[model samples]
Each structure stands twice: as structure tokens, then as C-alpha cells.
Target: MIRHIVFFRARDRADVGRVLEGLSILKTIPHSSRLEVTLNGKVDQLGNDVDVVVYGEFTDAAALAAYKAHPTYQESIDRVRPLRDVRMAADYEVTVD
Candidate 1:
């Protein structure tokens, strides 16, 4: 199994809602086994907010890849493109549970 994690920072606070909606679209992909989206609940000491986080679980790297190239994701990229400031992604194979 592969776990793909992502974190995004928006240029402004108004972008948060649209980003969350875009993250939710991942669940629509056929290969997506599990999907979780969370808003950053705490503010940093520097007064910066984390914005959003997405955790997606798939059967393998190919499945994860399919999810990334899926049309829903493409549409999401279009919707959030203007608002996105910084984005980060990481993928890992499940070692134990």
C-alpha cells in the first residue's frame, strides 16, 4: 500500500475553502482506497496558518499515479491553481499497519 500526503498553503485566507473542496474530490477516484482532508486547527507563533492537509491511501504506486492523473484531479488543479501559493507532497509505502 502507498500513502500519499500533501500540504498546501494559499496566498490568502479565502482560498482555504476552495482548496478543501478540491481535496475532497480525490475521494471520487476509483483507485482511492481512503481519503482524509483536514484544516490546520492551530496557528503558528509566526502567525502563519498551515491551510490544509490531505492523506490518501491506495493499493500501490500505480494506483496512486492513476489518482493523480484522474480527471477529477485535473479539474481540482484548475480550480485551485490561482489560489495556491506553496504545495508539498510526499509518498510512502506502508511498512507495517
Candidate 2:
């Protein structure tokens, strides 16, 4: 399985809601086995730079690719890019015995 995780910080703290609203569109896409958008919660004692989080699980690399290829993915980017201060993403394969 492929695990997809993305973190984002808004350019302005007040715009965090807008960023979340923008990312909400991704839920409409049907490619991933599971997908979610959430707030950072900022519970860590050291780092709270990230404001938004996107987490997804895909059956395989191809599924992950398809999720990215989905048109809503671009819409999410177009809407969030301008309001975001930073964006970070990581994808890794998960082995389930």
C-alpha cells in the first residue's frame, strides 16, 4: 500500500480556514482507497509550523498517481497555493504482513 501525507502552513494564520476549504475539494475525487484532510492540532511541544494536513492511502503507486491526476487535485492546488506559506509531502510504501 502507498501512504500519502502532505503538510501545509498558511501564509496568514487567518487564512487557514480558506486553505482547509480549498483542500476539502479533494474529498470529491474517487481514486484513493482512503483520504482525509485535517488541521495540524499543533500538539507537539517543539514544532507547530504546519497548519493543515492531508492524509491518503492508496492501493498501489498507480492508484496514488491517479489521485494526483484527478482534476480536482489541480483545483485544490490552484486554490491553496496562493494562501499557503509552505507545502510538504511524503509518500512511502507500507508493508502489511
Candidate 3:
């Protein structure tokens, strides 16, 4: 299995709602074992700057790649990119016991 995680920081606080709405499109993507989007609830003591987080689990790299290549996903990225100040993502294989 593979886990894909993304963190997004909005350029303007007012854009958070719009950004979240755009990102919600990911949940409609197929082949993901799990997909979720969350807004930051509280300020971090360490001052972490992320405003939103997207988490997804896929069966394998190919599944993740397909999700990324999906037109809806691409459209979501296009819609949200302009509203975000920074975006970061990571993907890794998960080992099950």
C-alpha cells in the first residue's frame, strides 16, 4: 500500500474555504483505499504553517499515479494552486505486519 500526504498553506486566510472546496474533489477520485481532507483546528505551538492536509491511501504506486493523472484531480490542482502560498506532498509505501 502507498500513503500520499499533502499539506497546503493558503496565500490569504479568506481563501481557505475555497481551497478546501477545490481539494474536496480528490475524494471523488477512484482507486484510493482512503481519502480525506482536513482543516487545521488549532494553532501549533511550534508554529507549523500548514492550513490544510490531504491524506490518501492507494494500493500501489500505479494507483496513486492514476489518481494524480485523473482530469478531476488535475482540475482541482489548477483551481487551488493560485490560492495557495505553499504546497508540499509526500508518498511512501506502507508495510503491513
Candidate 4:
């Protein structure tokens, strides 16, 4: 299993909603065991710049690759890129006994 995590910072705080909405399109891509888009809920934190987070769980590397290549996912990326200032991603394999 692979856990894919992405953190995004919007160009403007008001654009966060649009970014989240665009990212939701990833849910339609196949081979995703679980997918979620969430807003960062930081309270009174200093230097917290992340505005949104995308969490995805895939069966393996192939599934993750497929998800990234899907047209719908590409569309979402195109739409959200303009609204975001920064994006970071991480992928890790999870072992289940």
C-alpha cells in the first residue's frame, strides 16, 4: 500500500475553497483506495503556512502512477495550479501484517 500526501498553500486565502474543490476531482480517478481533501485547521499557530491537504491511499506504485496520469486528475491539477502558491507531496509504502 502507498500513502500519498500533499500539502498546498494558496496564492490567496480566499482561493482555498476553489483549490479544495478542484482537488476533489481526484476522487473520480480509479485505483484510489481512499482519497480526501481537507482544509488546514490551525488555531493560533505561528508560521503555519499550509492551507490545504490531500490524503490518498493507493494499492501500489502502479495505482499511484495511474492516478497521476488520469485525465481527470490532470484537469484538477491544471485548475488548481493557478490558485496555489506552493505544493508539496510525499509518498510512502505502508506494510500491513
Candidate 5:
């Protein structure tokens, strides 16, 4: 299994919702077994720099790749890239689902 996690920070605080909305486009793509886009709860006192989060689970690298190759993925990026200051993504393989 592959776990895909991405952290995003909006260029402006006011645009957080827009950023979240933009990333939501990913959910419409069917390549991932599970996908989510959400606002950070900011429960961590040490750092609250992250504004939005995208979490996805895929069966393997090919599924992950297909998710990225989906046109809506580009649409999401085109929509969010300009409004975001920082975007970071991490993906790893795990034995457990």
C-alpha cells in the first residue's frame, strides 16, 4: 500500500478555504482507494504553518501515478498553486492497509 500525504500553506490566510476547495478536486479522481482534503486542526502548538492537508491511500505506485496523471489533478494544481505559499508531499509504501 502507498500512503500519500501532502501539506499546503496558503499565501494569504483568507485563501485557505479556496485552497481547500481547490484541492478537493482530487477527490473526484477514482484512482485512489481513499482520498481526502481537509483543513488543518492546528492542534499542534509548536507549528501551525500548515493550512490544508490531502491524504490518500493507493494500492501501489501505479495507482498513485494514475492519480497524479488524472487531468483533475492538474486542474487542482492550477487552481491551488497560485494561492499557496508552500506545498509539500510525501509518499511511502507500507505493508499494512
Candidate 6:
């Protein structure tokens, strides 16, 4: 299994909802097994302006790649591109769970 995690820091925190909605579109997709959207909470430890965290799970790398190239994702990019400041992601194979 592959776990794809993404952190999005937006220029405006209010724009998080639009971005989250865009991500929700992928939940109904056939190849996507699991999708989660989280609103980052105010924590003193991490001062990052990251407002949203997206976690996606796929059976394999191919499935992850397909999710990235999906039209729904492209639409998301288009929607959030204007309000985004920076975005970072990491993907790793799940060994324990």
C-alpha cells in the first residue's frame, strides 16, 4: 500500500474550504481507495501557515500515479492555484499498516 500525504499552505486561510471541496471530488473515483481531508489546527509547535492536509491511500504506485493524473485532480489544481502559496507532498510504502 502507498500513503500519499500532502500539506497545502494557502495565502489566505479562508480559501481552505474551496481547496478541501476540490479534494473531496476524488472520493467517488473508482481507483481511489481512501481519501481524507484535514484542517490543520492551531499548534504552538508548528508555525506553518498550512491550512489543509490531505491523506490518500492507494493499493500501489500505479494507482497513486493515476490519482495524480486524474481530471478531478487537475481541476483541483486549477481551482486552488490562485490562492496557494506553497504545497509539499510525500509518498511512502506502508510497511506496518
Could you tell me the C-alpha RMSD of candidate 4 in Å?
Answer: 1.3
- Cα lDDT tens digits for candidate 2, 2-94: 999999999999999999999999999998888999998899999999999999999999999899999999999999999999999999999
- Give the per-residue lDDT of model 6 (tens digit) for 1-97: 9998888877777777887776667676667688887877758585856778888889998998888887888887887778778889999998655
**TM-score per candidate, in order?**
0.85, 0.97, 0.94, 0.93, 0.98, 0.85
For model 6 the local lDDT of residue 3 reads: 91
Question: Over all chains combined, what TM-score does candidate 3 have?
Answer: 0.94
Clashes of each: 0, 0, 0, 0, 0, 0
Per residue, candidate 4 scores C-alpha lDDT tens digits across 55-82 of: 9999999999999988998899899999
Instruction: Let me know the TM-score candidate 5 reaches against the reference structure.
Output: 0.98
Give the alpha carbon lDDT tens digit for every residue of 1-97 in model 1: 8999888888888879988887777777888788888887766787555688888889988998888888988997887778889888899988656
Q: What is the lDDT of residue 15 in candidate 3?
A: 99
Lowest summed lDDT over 10 consecutive residues: which window, candidate 6? 23-32
Once fitted onto the true fold, the runs of candidate 3 whose alpha carbons sit more than 4 angstroms away are none
Query: By the TM-score metric, which is better: model 1 or model 2?
Result: 2
| RMSD of every prediction | 2.0, 0.7, 1.0, 1.3, 0.8, 1.8
Candidate 3 residue pairs in clash (backbone atoms < 3 Å): none
lDDT of 6: 0.80
Which candidate, 2 or 6, has the higher TM-score? 2
lDDT for model 2 comes to 0.95
**Ordering by TM-score:** 5, 2, 3, 4, 1, 6
lDDT per model vs. reference? 0.83, 0.95, 0.92, 0.91, 0.96, 0.80
